[model samples]
Target: MKKLFFVGILAALFVGTTNVSAMTEADLRKKFDETVTINGNKYAVSDGDKKLADDYLAKYEVSSDDCDYIAKKIDEAKAILTAEGQEDLTKLSESTKTKLKKLVSDVSANTSVKGTVTSGSVVILNSDGSTFAEVTSLVKQTGTERSNIAIIAGVAFVITLVGACLVVKQVKNSNN
Candidate 1:
């Protein structure tokens, strides 16, 4: 009975310690969409210098540049999200827009403009002293209870082995 209990406990431990990758691509896609929409709106109205519409359009290229940078991040995240078999954008949260803006602002200030519109991928080169970083995904870690299961199972297995050793010794003595 004790042996069976220990085996059951060990089996449960292995089952409980499995690592599940929680950051699905679908979540990234939704975040990308939200970022594009929010940033696009901001870019359209950001006129650096007030003048004629054409003059504003010509001088207003800076906002477009910012928009393009945010767009590239969104596109990259979308591709990864799609390849991971996540097609739904509805799972993205409202807070994702705020998070993406902060990420873009941080990345943009440190990186230099790289590649033309003709390049397949928009590459942002890191400045001479700057490090390039991107916000990928936010995921929750495994719970403490799950981690404890492995320790409990390990102790149970050791106890079971000792019990089996004692039972074998008792049998040998009885037969002698």
Candidate 2:
């Protein structure tokens, strides 16, 4: 009877742990979407302001490892523009800048679109309470950062179950 009871407890523990861990991945994805949307919106808005642009140009020092490569590209472009002279390139420069700004806005819109699609999927899943493989694939594309949360949660849950099992076993042995 005690062995049966132990088995039941362990089974329940395992199932419960897995379910909790699975939910955490969804939660992390939701949080990541929220963060990206907020930050991207702010960046887009700040980039539109002339004062902010001047401030950014004056104070911005590129610190990332990738910054040097980006800076080199910028320098090369500037050298080409300077060689061509501002008078000849003014219209071209304005058009290029406009296109770049539009591209940034489009990218920001894409992020919003992704978030909306994920939210819609969540709503549909909740209404039906069904776990479709397609939904899982969508979440997976959001990146491993979301998936890693689930892994961490699963590990925590297993550790907790093992601790509980040890306690239960000790209790049962003492009673025996």
Candidate 3:
């Protein structure tokens, strides 16, 4: 069953890439904490994710239709995450999963652009970077691949060290 599902996903991704090459660009930029109130609570957008969106879009000539399609896929990714209750990358509906794979393959096909597009806690890259939704689909697709995992891991370690050092500095300052 799992194999069948993965096969289906891989098919979707390839289909998306073929179709997405002609897409135009869209405005996906957003400020840190850009939000709308939901049930009297403010829901914020991640600044890093916006930067990812900007970087990817700038590198490619995405058509308006593809742009909208991607934007919609982002929402669907979130809904899948919510419905599956965290880190269950296999929970997307068949159609939604197909669309997501398409976006991944599309992004991956653009060899000129190499990096990740993250939003909130989502890793939006599939061809090179890490995205749970995309990984299962691409695992079987073979080619001389470029991976950003090491770079991302190193950067993450550095960021953690910097954060720790800053926290220590703050603690010392408070003591003094």
Number of the top TM-score candidate: 3
Ranking by lDDT: 3, 1, 2
lDDT (10s digit) by residue, model 3, range 22-133: 4333312222223433234333333333344444444444454544554454455444434534233344455655555555555445432222323312233434454423
TM-score of predicted structure 3: 0.31
Candidate 3: 10-residue stretch with minimal lDDT: 1-10
Which regions in candidate 3 have their CA more than 4 angstroms from the true location? 1-27, 31-45, 87-103, 106-176
lDDT of each: 0.33, 0.31, 0.41
Candidate 2, 66-133: lDDT as tens digits: 23333333334334434434332223455444433333233223321111123212111111334211
Ranking by TM-score: 3, 1, 2
**Number of backbone collisions per candidate:** 1, 0, 6
**Alpha-carbon TM-score of each model against the true structure:** 0.28, 0.22, 0.31
How well does model 3 score by local distance difference test? Answer: 0.41
Considering only N, C-alpha and C atoms within 3 Å, which residue pairs clash in candidate 1?
A: 25-81
Q: What's model 2's lDDT at 114?
A: 12
Candidate 1 lDDT over residue span 1-176, tens digit each: 00111111111111111112332445423322232122122111111111121232222223334445544554543343333332233233435433433343443453232211111111222334332222111234657987799999999999999999999999999999
